[model samples]
Target: MKSKITVMLVDDHAVVRAGHRMLLSQYENISVVAETARGEEAYQRYIEIHPGIVVMDINLPGMGGLASIRRIHGRDPYARILAFSVHDEPLYVTRALEAGAKGYVTKSSAPEILVEAIIRLAQGDTFVDPEIAQRMVVQTVTGTDPSSLLATLSAREFDIFRLLVNGRTTREIAEELCLGYKTVANYATQIKSKLNVRTTAEMTCLAYQYGVLNG
Candidate 1:
């Protein structure tokens, strides 16, 4: 008998998690082994349960989904994570991939697409929503995508950049990420230097122009 593929669901919404569990349960070969509403707890759960695949939402309550993916991948290089986010921008997909998620799917994707993504990741294949993949291709070919502008930032820097552009104060970012205020401030300065913006207002403008600000 084939062993069922185990999955961990990480999202901040109880109803969304329930919906995902119900949808994934229809597949006899798949089972949800664990679920959580916070990225910090999700990593701890992954360490404890070690599910076959992780379906994570990028906009998590604590630690953020990108950080969680990075932490898990750092612990287990073979870890397979499918980044499920509401943002359809190619930049979000790129950031998730850079953070070590094996696949990216938007919330707008069909239920079957999510199922297919989970199965494919479990089978050692990567998957991205077809629409997102096509958009990425188009952006790459056109050379107009702002993703290239921000690609130089590391995963941590990218996370900080996102927070800074969204009007988050240094202390707020530190509290959210559980980092020291000084460390977060340093990251903020570095992010501004990398993006070539001197002021938070300019950073916000750049983010808005590049479509990096979450809608």
Candidate 2:
């Protein structure tokens, strides 16, 4: 017998969540148990509902989805999170994976892609959109030259690296991640030492060249 799949929705838009709920309702094999707009609530709901799949958006208004996914996965490594977002850019996709997301699907995808992501998650497989997957493979081989330059960075260092390359100031990253300005500044120093990059602009240039930002 095919067991029904339980899904939890985490998107900031009410109408978008409603639309997903309505669409998933058409499939007898899937159930939408809970929905949340904030990252904190999504984390709470995941624990309470223990849904088979979690469809989340990356750019939540509060706390952010990618960070939430990392926290949730830390608590429950078995949790299945499929990032469904309008941001199909490689940076978004790569960050989601580093943060422990199991699947990545763009919101602009056809309905079948959504269905396929859910099914793949249900079967305990990682899912990435075809375009994203191919890009990742090529980057994995060619991205090593400069991308691996940061191999020694800690998780926090990597976070700082990404934000810096994207032109976020230390003050800005601190505010976004809820850390004190000095705290983020400290992370910047650590990242530079680990990556051997002397300046933020230099790191940004390298990040672009190695497809860390482009991918």
Best of the candidates, lDDT: 1
Q: Report the poorest 10 consecutive residues by lDDT, candidate 2.
A: 144-153
Clashing pairs in 2: 90-215, 91-215
Off by over 4 Å in 2: 89-91, 141-154, 158-172, 191-215
Give per-residue CA lDDT, model 1, range 139-179, as digits (tens): 88988776677888888888888888877889998999889
Best candidate according to TM-score: 1
**Lowest lDDT 10-residue stretch of candidate 1:** 206-215
Give model 2's TM-score versus the native structure.
0.77
lDDT per residue (tens digit) for residues 62-106 in model 2: 467778899899989999999877766565676788888999998
User: What's the lDDT for residue 19 in model 2?
Assistant: 90
Would you list the clashing residue pairs of candidate 1? Answer: none
Which lDDT values do the candidates have, in the order given? 0.90, 0.82
